[model samples]
Target: MTQWTAEQPIVSIRDVHKSYGQVEVLRGISMDIMKGEVICIIGPSGSGKSTLIRCINALNDIQAGSIQVEGQEVHDAKLDKLALRRKVGMVFQQYNLFPHKTALQNVMMAPIKVLRENPAEVEARARALLKKVRLEGKENHYPGELSGGQQQRVAIARSLAMRPDVMLFDEVTAALDPETVKEVLVTIKDLAADGMTCILVTHEMGFAREVADHIYFTDRGVIVEHGAPAEFFTNAQDPRTRAFLDQVL
Candidate 1:
């Protein structure tokens, strides 16, 4: 346990664990995500990569340990979870857009309903976010009308509308066609370039190598190895990490 200092991480997970009934899913996981750091979590399916990030955002409750976003304990009963959610935005593999709502409306829904922010101000920010993801004119289009790439970009914009301090992306490109994957990746890379604190669970090894400030290789619900891009991909310390990289890279 460490006290907050000048360099304290924005998101901190300490000995976190999760399970479904008796089957343990996360095994004593711990990590620190510094401000402006892009952390890429890579592993075989079911290795708890997505679960860890979900826990950080409190999308799923953990049985033990603690997670803190901006120093507020995520598991605290008295803490405002809705306010915490504004600080940590998440995008899933599925776009999860409201089919009834257009892109601009979808992005504006959260801030207006949850934060009670002014509709005019939220609309302005929503438009800018859509433009940032290269979907300026598509704001009027519904999710069903856009391509897979376009929809995912809208999802990104919807998340950014909250002005989150940390963004958790859970296998965002898995469902997209090969042709459309790059466009989504490029949109994410642009965010990384802008110094967003992002944690992405991705199978796109090359993109992870290019954009990640730190990389973690997990297995069986535990982090087996972690390091900078070059150090991790080139010289993974754990056998499981090496095996995973050998297969992916």
Candidate 2:
């Protein structure tokens, strides 16, 4: 893993709360992500793990509290959501690729359109990113032509093309076949090793144990337990965390 110099947090969540109509999904949640940190969020379905990350990028609006990325308030009316999104890349479980576009085109599209970079340069960077993910030869393949793992890697490459300071992954390997999960996990592990600030919501305890600097266990819209991976996975002090781990792991 790349050695990260200890410094100020790159992302901060302060007393954040979210609700969909009358249904409260997040309740006064707070967390901090330091530069180059890999934080994993694990919880039962509907515990607000996904909602929290979505709110960080303004994909989901919060009813109360604050989320800040790189010291800029994410929910402020004057804040530019587009600019914030460009800095905080996200990868979803469903390899949300443009089926009509080839892998390289998909990676190049955002940097060319959003950042307004040179097309040739963006294409070259996209190709290099694909190669980094071990998808070099598959660049010309459309999403339909690739397997689930390949498409997910392309989605990751697409996100990385934005050169985000922080990456949010929401159950990225949940939909993959068991045999295919390792490849995607390997790519993510590489990112963690490279010291990319990452926040992942996943059920893969082994991956969390192996790569995450900190693991949070959430329940009923609250972060019930959080600690280093070694402590959280093996010696979690909370019963709720242990129960959840037993059921899932």
Candidate 3:
């Protein structure tokens, strides 16, 4: 395995901060994500795991510090937000597919509209991506007709259609039924195996242990601990990390 700790960063966050009204969320956080690294972040609800990643893709603006992706500043005033988004795909807990569109249509829209790719080519790639996520024949199925897991898979295919450099998954399996969670997890595992850079914020400790190259523990708006799966899971040093692990693991 490559030593990600020594590698140049694909996403670099420096002393980041975020807040809502009078309440502060992220507080002076810093981390560098290396290319082809699968990073999983775990924490209690309201610990700012989602917020941090949101800032990474500029979904939420930071109050202080900077986030750089592939040498481009994410929050720069003149930054081409749409262009940045094309390089960083994000999946949320809810399967936010367009109700009126078929699975394939959902996956094909961005590449066609935003990237202005040939419609025929986009359709072909969409079909392949849907199949990659194990949705071989469901291309014609609408979101409402599919199960939550299948819908989530379509969401993944949609993100993959953009051909992003980094993928951020925020509690993707959280809303799925117990049995369906496995299918989504399997899809993500396959992506990891295919060498996609993934940053996942999940409550699925087992899945994180299996798929994540680095595990991060966040608490009260700060990264409290981080380590390789073996080190973080077995020999955590921070009290907050140990206590949280005690509850989850």
lDDT of all the models against the reference? 0.91, 0.92, 0.93
**CA RMSD of each candidate after superposition:** 1.7, 3.4, 3.3
Q: Give me the overall lDDT of model 2.
A: 0.92
Clash count list over all predictions: 0, 0, 0
Model 1, stretches more than 4 Å misplaced?
A: 1-6
Ranking by lDDT: 3, 2, 1
lDDT of 1 by residue, 40-117 (tens): 999999998888898888889999999988888998888798889888999999989999999999999999998899
Model 3, CA-based lDDT: 0.93
Candidate 2 has its poorest 10 consecutive residues by lDDT at: 1-10
Task: Please give the distance, in angstroms, between residue 119's alpha carbon in candidate 2 and its true position after superposition.
Answer: 0.9
lDDT top scorer:
3
Model 3 spans with C-alpha error above 4 angstroms: 1-7
lDDT of 1 at 62: 93
Candidate 2 has which clashing residue pairs, if any?
Answer: none
